[model samples]
Target: MLDIGIIGASGYTGGELMRLLLSHPQARVELATSRRLMGQKVSATHTHLKDMVDIQFENPDPHEIKDRCDVVFVAVPHGTAMNIVPKILDDKVKVIDLSADYRLKPAVFEDVYGIKHLDPRNVVYGMPELHPEIKHEGFIANPGCFPTGATLAAAPLAQASMIDSVVFDSKTGVSGAGIEPSQASHYPNMAENVQPYKLTKHRHLPEFTQELQRLDKNLTNISFTPHIIPSVRGILTTAHIFTKGTLTKYDVMDLYTEMYQDKPFVRMMDGIPSLSAVKGSNFCDIGFEVDPRNNRVVVISAIDNLVKGASGQAIQNMNIMCGLDETTGLWVPGIAP
Candidate 1:
């Protein structure tokens, strides 16, 4: 069994990784670290995993982790991962970082993050659907939540060179903001409200543009707008796409079906997908409608913000990296209301 270490295990992504890894059959949890919750029981921070994990939250020490784990999942914030990943790389421990630190090229990374990238050569952007070959390589930089959904929604069209400009309007849950409570995510402030933030400049913008461009160099323009809904989890991304050539709705659906036919996590639906359909699972349900009236197409996609957006995708990468079935330990059905 592959021994796994989770660095920065106090936040929602880290806790979710713990919950998922505990049940992973081919892997074992070796270490879980958190700076603030050091020495505290894992269950104390996330009560949902009370009986599942008896491990305590330890301090972030690369040496300690390198001694125990064959691979490490760095679930920390963006800039923080860059500081320690270089040292971990020296130990030859494979890493899957759920941060934007190394998602783009050094120039794009610096431009979007406004920070110089310390180690650009060692990391690969970790969007399994887009770059499945990267799994054979070592280090991975997991895509952002919004990029995960948006990219998946538009990838088929981009691959076919059928789309002109794509406009992504995504609605995400409060949990996407992270576990560190903020005023915008406060109960009263979020309840019964739909607020659109990060209108012009969101970090995920560069990621989406960069990834899509990899598929089609002519795919130049994208308008991505993200909103925070009152829900606790899940993301619903609606992409308003202008097709360059004539294509029927059925044709677009067939293209997606053919593209993701082998991908276990992607579910192509006949009707539009809702958040409830994908919550708590690794599945990304996609559906689309043809707007011949305006010669446009509306593509809808949904995924659990914490699952496909974070922990589940991370585990999927691990499965691929370890040469296990990608669907292993990810068979849970979506939780219904």
Candidate 2:
């Protein structure tokens, strides 16, 4: 069995990690750290995981985690992971970080994050379906929530050289903002509203564009926008893509179907998929329509922002890194309203 530790275990992503890992057949939760809730029982902060795990949240200390587990999932924010990851890179442990710290090349990292990377060359992007071969690498950088939905929707088109340009508009739940209480995410403002924030400067933009460019160098002129809805979970991304060649809607559908044929997590639907359909599960459901008159194709994808978008994907990477079944502990169905 692989022993797993999670850093930053008080937030939405960390709680989701605890929920999923509690049922994993071959994995055990050894330690989960949270600076805010140190020494508190895991169940105290996240009632959903109350009886599922008996572990307590601890403070972030590399020495405490390195000796207790074979792998670690860093669920902390961007700048924080950089400070902790480098210290825990001994040969005994593998790490999957669910932050934007090492998702891009050093130059691109600097451009988007506005910081010179302290160690950029050692980490690989951790979207398993997109980069399966790199799963065994020592360190992995999990993709952002918005990028996960957007990239899966447009990857097939980008890979086929069929898309000329792409515009992505993502609507996600307020929980994606994290467990912290902010004025924007306060119940009064978010309860009955759909607000569009981060118009052009969402941090996920560079990670999204960089991955698409990796698949097709000709993929240029991409635009992305993200919004926050009042819901508690899920991300719905719509990609407006201009095709380069003559391809019908059926052709585009076929491309996505074939591309994800062997992949178990991506679900291709005939009609548009709703956010509730994929909530609480690690599935990315995609559907698209053709706008022949405008020479465009519209692709829509949905995922539970906290699950597939963050902690679930981090666990998927851990399974791959450890040579276990990729779907080991993540086969639960979506929770319906």
Candidate 3:
């Protein structure tokens, strides 16, 4: 079994990593680090994983972490990862950062997130379905939750260069914000209502731009708007993909199916995808329809923002980096109610 460490293991994504990796057949949790929750049992911070793991939260020392773990997942915020990752990264240990630090180029990252890169370097964008060659790399930058769902929803169309303008409207759960309590995440503010934040821009905007531009350089018409719903987990992205010419529903379905046929985690839905259908699982359920009158093909993609969107996808990246089955710890069906 491979020994793994999770830095910043007190937040939603970190707790999720603890939950998923505790059961991973080939990976064992060796260390779970949190600067604030030091010495506390990991399960104490993540009550949901109370009986699932036995590690305590320790303050991170990059050198010690490198010596202890075969692989490490950095679950800290965007700016926080650059501090830890720059210290421990080398060929002796593999790193997967679930942060935006390494997802975009220095200029673009600084422009979007309004921050400077202290230790910028190239790392594979960890979306195994889109870029399975992630298997060949030692370090990976996990895509943002919003970008993962939105990109998968519209990538096929972008690649075919059949699009004119693409507008992505995504509804995400509160958990996507993180484990920290926030004025935005306040129960009364979020309950029985939907609030749309980042109307024209979000930090995840650059990720979609980088990935899609790889397929078609001239495709500049990408727009994303995100909303927060009252739910605890999941992101549903409705991509209003306008094509250069009219295409039938059958044609678009074939395109997505052909692209994702061999990808295990991306499930092509026969009908519209439901949030409940993909909740608590590492599946991205994609369903679409063609509105011939307006030349609009509405594609809906759903995923548990904490699963396929974050921790589960992180584990998927580790699986690829270690030359294991991409779905090793994450092939189970969703916990549909």
TM-score to native of every candidate shown: 0.97, 0.96, 0.98
Q: Worst lDDT window (10 residues) for model 3?
A: 43-52
Cα lDDT, model 3, residue 302: 99
lDDT of each: 0.88, 0.87, 0.89
Ranking by TM-score: 3, 1, 2
lDDT of 2 by residue, 131-153 (tens): 98755587889999999999999
Candidate 1 all-Cα RMSD: 1.2
Give candidate 2 misplaced runs (Cα > 4 Å). Answer: none
How many residue pairs clash (N, CA or C atoms closer than 3 angstroms) in each of the candidate models, in the order given? 0, 0, 0
* Span of 10 residues, lowest total lDDT, candidate 1: 118-127
Under the 3 Å rule for N, CA and C atoms, how many clashes does model 2 have? Answer: 0
Looking at model 3, residue 289 earns an lDDT score of 86
Residues 218-331 of candidate 1 have per-residue lDDT tens digits of: 998899889999999999999999998778877887889888999999998889898998888999999899998777989999999999999999999988887888888998
Name the lDDT value of residue 2 in candidate 1. Answer: 92
Q: Which regions of candidate 1 are displaced past 4 Å?
A: 90-92
Off by over 4 Å in 3: none
